[model samples]
Target chain A: MADVARLAGVSHQTVSRVVNGHPNVREETVLRVRRAIEELGYHRNSTARALVTRRTNVLGVIAFDTTLFGPAQTLSGIERAAREAGYFLSMVSLDDVSPDGIVAAAEYLVQQSVEGCVAIAPQRSLVDALAALPGPHPLVAVEGGEGSGLPVVCVDQVQGAHDAVRHLLELGHTTVHHIEGDPLWLESEARVVGWRRALEEAGAPAPEPLQGDWSPRSGYALGRSLVARRAEGERVTAIFVGNDQMAIGVLRALHEAGLRVPGDVSVVGFDDVPEAEFLTPSLTTVFQDFAQVGKESLALLLGEIGTERNGSPGPSATERRVVPARLRVRGSSGPPPP
Target chain B: MADVARLAGVSHQTVSRVVNGHPNVREETVLRVRRAIEELGYHRNSTARALVTRRTNVLGVIAFDTTLFGPAQTLSGIERAAREAGYFLSMVSLDDVSPDGIVAAAEYLVQQSVEGCVAIAPQRSLVDALAALPGPHPLVAVEGGEGSGLPVVCVDQVQGAHDAVRHLLELGHTTVHHIEGDPLWLESEARVVGWRRALEEAGAPAPEPLQGDWSPRSGYALGRSLVARRAEGERVTAIFVGNDQMAIGVLRALHEAGLRVPGDVSVVGFDDVPEAEFLTPSLTTVFQDFAQVGKESLALLLGEIGTERNGSPGPSATERRVVPARLRVRGSSGPPPP
Candidate 1:
């Protein structure tokens, strides 16, 4: 601390106030101190700093603001992980993924001098916006890539989708139908690619995918089309939905159309969300380890912050670590009704 | 901005760097300007501030870290409102209501220079923690008390519970059985109180409340006890579950025990989550206006910030606005089975 103060040409008290996040420090002094700290590769153990600085211990997590199962799970997972790691979390939900929102969140964090940050970017807009901002401190992105190049941690959606479709093929199904999530989501696109690759690998027919907005209503509306095909005797025997919620709707549509599940039609969904097992005839779906995603993202962010303190230069090795997803078989899927 | 710089005895460039959220500022100068601004109660119009600041025009949102229906819906509501209000959101989630987490989130927002902030404190921990810290900027709590005496907006859980119980009473049931959420949650406690008050007023048996953790698994476990009681010739003909997820579990348990919904037993749930209407027998539950909760909280926070800028002393008036919850009748609830 004294060395940083010396390098920045400031008193130890001034450094203490800045490190403690007093919010009354001069902007210029903060910049100089930060630069000095970076140049000297000085890192403060917040716990030790708190003893002298009378500071509160906290870690802020910035995530995509949504109730979608993925985001919700990720949020819960991060919170649990943060708690386990001896940090508390403060949350912010953005109305849009704009540059202003990113800057605002960043400024808010700076004012608080949040020890570190984990920003969950499920969409492209947030990633780009965050990438342009100056490296304020240790920032990590969950599922964010492209220009941000920040350390990313995400579930292996492409591999998960591949496994789900491959399961159907192994069951001797000639072809499988797909119900995908919103096209804009990276996971959604990745799943689409995996689905196509699986079908192509086996020389199976790949029908034009059915579009969905990750809602049961969207699935229900699109399910009607599949039902119509069933009535015309040209039905696709197995369906892999983007999520469990939409899968429920598809099941309802099939039931209403007099098609028995796993008998007349087989179904598989992603995100083995809660309630999947309790569905009238439990659902077969892919399970994502969201808790793992949260834990890894935090660890990754902390690592980057630690490295930055060591004066490591030239874009830290930011790479995506994909968590694996598993298939849970139940009543919703089986061999195509012979 | 110039006046603040002059008053604080800092250079114009230093003030610009502070306002623009440049990471290169000194902590001491930052504190001086902040104190001066507070003393002057000076606030910059974000739009004009944006032009000079070169910010991305983004706002950070502290999201409730849960997959529970209410929190998810409220988050989505905030996102939608933010977009309409012409801002973007960067969100963070915490696992538990840890003061450290809340502080971390607040600090993160401060560093980002977020125009303002809203903390969703369904649990008391976050709220109590936020109270201890010096608020860095405009702040509000959703589903939390107007306790901070700051602007507060939320769905009236007390009223919602009252409406649910009253509806059950009006249906000719002697008394409604209650399945309560975790006792620690403020909303849960509020609902429990409302349920108890309604029953006490009607001189009906409150029947030591059955406990649930707001999960289908817990609901299923509790439902088994009810089913066993029925087998022993005791029956709870009508039940009010705390949330839809739990209600689904209760319904499944009863179904497995050969009891028919609204036939052998009547059940009602809260949240009226999207899939509630599609449940096998559908669900009769309470509908909360999540969007209203989000909009009102934002307005309250922004309004409070506005008042602060106008040099008003504290809030003009305490807003204890509780958006009402409605009873949505479906196949789940009915008169006591003959």
Candidate 2:
């Protein structure tokens, strides 16, 4: 930096201002400093700068199961938001969901001097673990359920499920059977709650919900069981699945049994994935705006960071931001059989 | 650190050894140092340690469009491998695929002092840009095409495509129609090459491939076009789509057009996504081992880093690692229109 300043015939402070993009620098002086920097092949060392300014301009993101559609899309949204905000991301994806592992991952980010953290904590256990973390201040949790006493940003999962079930019920289905996702996820629990609430409100009996591991195979197996139940004279007409991938399985299983979608049975799914619209019967699904969730989470975390920097008290534990979910009615859902 | 050493009644060297998990430290001394660290709330400052030792133990990953199944799975695999190797990852996902954007992302990682970098460069432009980067040595490109003079790790896209097309031809199809993915990606290009080569080998006329954006909607549109061609008395008995998502759309289009899969028209797709097996006819597709690609890329990157650290000339620019793709036969492919 000193050599560049000397070569540019400018004060060290002027060179610093030009490098840092300070607005007050004269255009010619800025040009001269940039040329000098280019000529000397001087690249700013963020590590040294972080030490001097106590700022890394790097945020930490803790994610799990990026192979899943929701988490992958959410992570992508967050990455874009972070980049737009001029902050780099230090990412840690947890293969082990143990409490110790979560804590260790957070500590690792802290060691790297991340300014703040946003954890895509979709599981109840993960939210609890993150809530228990002692420090790594200015943390925000995404898709984390309530009562953890942490700032959170998430889609309205319960409402989304309720809307889908209500749509099914309005189409003259006496009740809606749910094929819930992995029970370990808070999303599954919330969707279950919504499904049950919708059924109760409609004065209908709720059958035992089948649990799936959020895989198509599980959905196919569960769908076969439903087919068997219908064969035994059970009234199985409308089905609301936890996610689109599993819905695809259920669609196949129903087809193999010679049952027509929306003719003999109606099916609905969540997570309006890209392929959902082009499914054999075009799935009626709930759309969670993962990009909005990501943006809101980052905004909340940045606000917390600002408060911390200003020496103000942090955000309240119950502080939450909820993005709305919309139901897309498609060919797979319709009136029940006469 | 000094406070921890003083509190533990140990030399600074002993404290350092314990913190670093050196094998030579006495068990009792290690316990004492750990207790001191816990009591003092001492978190090792990696920034300072990096300054002293010039080792950040953080690797950089550059990825684009991770919402896609392949890239998302590949990233998950890399994260698992990096964690197992006890390394932290600094990740940058490029929303802009321009050469300048790629360079800026690389430069950002370099500023953060990453020990090495792994770029998921699947596009021709991306590989060219990365190959042109001045420094940030020990870089490995994943899914990057050949002839860029860079160490590359990718699944055998051409071979995978060849196998899929050959399977259809073996099923007694006179010719196979193609639905290629976005032309900008190297994977799509390789698949196109393989598809053309298979047609030439079989002495069958090669049909001009329809291009899709790797989305179910695009596939649906193109499938409808194929249906129109069939209506005009053209043979449209077989199709090989570039991806499972688009294949889903094609299936819907065919079903709507009253064409039975594997009966009137045989279909195949690449990227056997989780939903592939559960699609209406249970798609026959090529499965790319993304996890293997991730692991191989990281191993290759670590090898480059080791060589760089040892002051070696580094691996040859032509160094390449290829993970094989497998063909999974299922319900979607059979004798065409017999």
Q: Candidate 2 on B100-174: residue-level lDDT in tens?
A: 989999988888788888999889999999989985677899989988888999999999999999999998999
**Per-residue lDDT over B18-52 for candidate 1, one digit per residue giving the tens place of the 0 to 100 score:** 86688988898898988888787565544344435
Taking all chains together, the TM-score of candidate 1 against the true structure is 0.71
| DockQ result, candidate 2 | 0.80
lDDT of 1 by residue, A203-310 (tens): 999988999988888877778899897678775899989988888788878877888888888889999878887776678999999889988887786677668668
Q: What is the TM-score of chain A in candidate 2?
A: 0.96
Off by over 4 Å in 2: A9-14, A22-31, A314-317, B10-14, B22-31
Candidate 2 lDDT: 0.91
Candidate 2 chain A weakest lDDT stretch, 10 residues: A310-319
